[model samples]
Target: MPTIPSNIVVYNLITKRLFSTSTSKNMNYVEKVRLLDYWKIQDSSLQNEFPRSHLVLMVDRRLLVTKDTPDVKMVEHSYGDLKQLLGEYGLQFDLSNSCLLDALPADNDMIPLFGTSIEAADPPEDSPISKSDVLKQLGNSLGGRFTDIRMAMLTMQEERQRNLLAKFQTLTKWAATYRRCPKCAAALKMRTSKSGAECVTCQKVYYPTFSPVSITLITDPTNEHALLVRHRGSAGGVFTAVAGFAHSGESMAECARREIAEEVGIEVDLIQSLDMSQPWPMPDSSLMIAHVAIAKMDQKISVCPDELETAQWFSRQQVRQALETTLSDPQLKKLPRTLDDRQTLHYIPPAGAIAHQMIRRWVDGKIDFHNSRI
Candidate 1:
């Protein structure tokens, strides 16, 4: 058994303790949702509970979700049903790779959710099932279709389900991508209840990887305006807070400062951290850390042409408008080009995104940089 990193261990302990308590006033949706708690169950008991537990299947990275309005629900299957379906599809349900993702709330029966993935079945030449036929047949049988995970995340009404899908996708992607150990090209087996994997030859355990990204909303000295930038290939008239991945051993705050300088050629001091961290799974798994940076003085708007199309400050009202637009229509992709005009309307990220939360907090005065850091 490979030793888990001490920092990760400490983080898990602290978060588990905090979430297990009743003090949920300030906790975010992700924090409020109950993650995997399989350590509480014995292996023998886990098997007994599996048949009754709800199964969330991810076929080729898409989530199985029922078509509905306002709230999208993940299609749940029994373990026996799952086994039978996989057998029909020429696939196997590996118990070792079945990951417990989340537990429903007390009012919802507190049923445990087991997430497992099955590759698209490549049927035999003589078989009637085609390459893409599995998805259609499974959808017909389950009364749901395989939905794009991103679309499912956006339309999901319940925050708990959204968080569960994010976790499930991240874990599933990690397992699928890293089949062999880095040190030795040996087959890896699921370990720690599929939360991690261990190399068969080296006995080294690999944990899920989440790259840390610093997303900061920069405010001027007056705190009346916020700085947002648009990448070259980004949607028209859409701008978002500065974001960059932290380099090795670099603090998140420093990463924010460096990104600000590199993208917009401005210097900013960290105001404070916000309670807006999110686990994003697109492009790659990332832990988005939110913060506020204040430009102590007037700064030039020298845009890094290689990095950004434009960088400019917008009034609180503008930011508010963009947020409202996002709320009214999250699917709105095209906006009138106005990155040059600081007074005009511009859009921010969707409400589910941490960047959107950061901007909203700044506008709502929740992120008061005027107050001294306690």
Candidate 2:
């Protein structure tokens, strides 16, 4: 399995956990929502403009793909690659009952073929345009990537198959509710023909949700080592750099120091900024603000047990080897092993976590791995 992108972010504002289809096979109910990526689901205009190739969902939160047997059309490569993609991330998915091939209606010529990644996105709002330009914009938003789309098709574990109906119904209700005006008493409606919502009375528009956050790796004087901390209750198991949320009416740098103080109990200094960001989704809206900061005191360290267990400083050399795939998962023998604090890198974030992306940047110098601040 390709290293399941230890900190890859699929969408900045939303998140999905990575679990093997084998381990979670028994779950049903709300857990099944994992099957849907609400970030990319389309509206009515989307339906007329780009015929949906298929609707994939989990029957029992076990990895099932469902499609109307009669709705099959264009010859599609069986969705086997999706399985490989999941596996590389150290995750599992079931494909035994998945729809091997499916198609779309002929009139739906505007519909696009599926592939490995998100293809269409709303174009930047700053461009000047013409008719062809407008059409191209719409195409790019829906056409997505033309090939290598990794999808599991319609497959699921079975016990939760009946529950999917309720889940679909819930989504339909939310779709209708989302179209309404939250501020005004006026009834809201979906433009489905375009990119947002319309208020029937006030002519207001509401777009999809996107949230922003800030994350950083803080280091201290002498550049001998950087601030490393363990999460609360990690039992000195997992280790990671300091990071925190960027708050309202505050700058990213301010958030960096505040989070470091709150987590590691040290004052930050001589902070230099890095222009790398990742859209992290943990089931809510968030954009990762990745940066590097300096601390005044390198050796005087104390950790907050409620937020962090113990704090240490690791040299760049030790970090490079510790993060190596072959030797990455190290054992923690004492509460203070290296710095008289027993801590190991135990708590790795989600499959597409932002912290993971920042580490890669420090190592690979490939800011393009993420879409923002590259």
Candidate 3:
């Protein structure tokens, strides 16, 4: 039997969207024909079609945006607009180096463009051109700023747009990483269908891969407190549920238990799985499978010093307070100076994260940790 049931709805920062999933695929036959025409023309030459209003440009991993005003403005340049901007930076504008991130179903003219510079020279290995330096130059040329992709995902309001951005990032990264065949040392070319790469020499087709990870929140036997750990080099004062990549040939339940034991030296009985899964883009694309577990015999945690900085059990009340702390604005809210004997500088994962969702569910009486314990 599968540890994670099929009916469970996986939760994660990027997976939960406010908009319906069908929004991206709602085009009619006329629209489909129009899009086919656009692609046909685009395949021939970028000069054939008129430029749209917005273009989402990604150089390496950063996004070009305008941050001069209070609200950050993403740079959505039309083909002509982007062409002019690239010309100023001594970059070429080629359709071969660009792709559509997403198209608007409502407005036929509102197509989102994603472009990367294919002609830029590879920097030397010893002293490569810094990502910051490249972004600075691009920002200067475009008269805008560049923001990290993670930051952009956090601040972007439109759910559909965020989903599109993730797809773009995932596809672009896959292309860069799989430029050569793994089976044989041969160059690979994108398939005509644009779904995967095919090796020129061996003719092996390779598709994109997504890593699966298991993330769990373990509660004490009494179910009054939850175990949270701080990873080494994590942002100051922030702590989240324990997580690790699923090992080869291991079931999700087996991986969850092993990761819990390996990371914090705590034995846990597998409890009911959380219905939420999230797509984590950092450190590469991964599917985060979340679960709830209860500490078996040993409630006391022994932190793996190399992997985690600290491991502690926070009372349900404390977890609630930490969630509140994360949601409150810095200037408007004031937290207690101290809770019990510890300083009140606790910072939990952001509300968008699956970890935060698990904590919130536990606090809200939605997850019956004690009753669900194995």
Best by lDDT: 1
Q: Which lDDT tens digits does candidate 1 get at residues 205-279?
A: 788898999888888878888888887776676688988788897788888888788889988865567767877
Return whichever of 1 and 2 wins on TM-score. Answer: 1
TM-score each candidate: 0.76, 0.48, 0.71
Give the winner by TM-score.
1
| Pairwise lDDT winner, candidates 1 and 2 | 1
* RMSD (Å) of each candidate, 1 decimal: 6.6, 19.6, 9.6
Q: lDDT tens digits, residues 59-125, model 3?
A: 6557776766544446677677778878775667554455445444434233434545344444457
Number of residue pairs clashing in candidate 3, backbone atoms closer than 3 angstroms, sequence gap of 3 or more or interchain: 10
Model 2 per-residue lDDT tens digits across residues 176-286 = 347558888687665332224567888676754435566767655555455667777544445667766777887877888777777777887645456666543233435
Which residue window of length 10 is worst by lDDT in model 2? 146-155
* Candidate 3 runs further than 4 Å off: 1-54, 65-75, 93-100, 106-144, 154-161, 191-195, 329-345, 369-374
TM-score of 1: 0.76
